[model samples]
Target: MLWLKERGIASVAESVLNSEELDKTVAHLLVAARNDGYAQGYAECSHHVVNALKVDWDTSKSATHGVNTEVALAAAKMQFNNLQLPVMDLIDVALHSEDHVAQLKEIFPDRQEDEDEDLA
Candidate 1:
């Protein structure tokens, strides 16, 4: 409708209007919207958390302290434990799937190389 077009939702309105199963179409749209929102929120939160952690680490007196494996491991463990349930769940899901692991490696090839270097 003209109102939908004015509101910038004309395509969505048209899709719903053209759908044979309006309820299902609406449900699908809702799910897609929710997934998009979750992804966006997750990305924003990740960026914020990473930036905060980086700032804290950079400004900390401990930044000058040479690497201590025990301290680093403890800090990593604490950070992992502090993560939200949703984030932990997503991580678990990804780690449990070979395809997901492969996808992650593909997406973050540098990270994988860093991990390999760490092991070496």
Candidate 2:
């Protein structure tokens, strides 16, 4: 993704998005979210969470579509415990959404405004 590429997290984001295992994807995102500093990692992982689940990785969509609810719930809990603030909202929307990509867009918002400001 453009955003991930911009942040130098595109490789990990690609891996996270490409992975078929829900638990593994969530685990990878958590590690990235924790390890790469809050803002950068969270942005990258969260964006890919939406993209991965929305795209569902493979043709059938079953791979990501049927992600274990327990894993998602646990991931949400851990994120809230660890990050706090607006990230909790982002996590909640992502885990609960019927359409994760759209929900994430609404909740997390794009950095376009910030990017524009930077250019200015």
lDDT scores in order? 0.47, 0.51
| Model 2 per-residue lDDT tens digits across residues 47-115 | 687797885333234323333444545665565456434444555667587875555555445567668
RMSD to the true structure for each prediction, in A, is 25.5, 21.4
Q: Judged by lDDT against the true structure, how good is candidate 1?
A: 0.47
Error of 2 at 79 (Å): 15
Worst 10 residues of 2 by lDDT: 57-66
Best by TM-score: 1
With candidate 2 superimposed using the best TM-score fit, by how many Å does residue 115's alpha carbon deviate from the native? Answer: 6.1
Name the runs in model 1 displaced over 4 angstroms. 1-20, 55-120
Score residue 50 of candidate 2 by CA lDDT. Answer: 72
TM-score of each: 0.30, 0.24
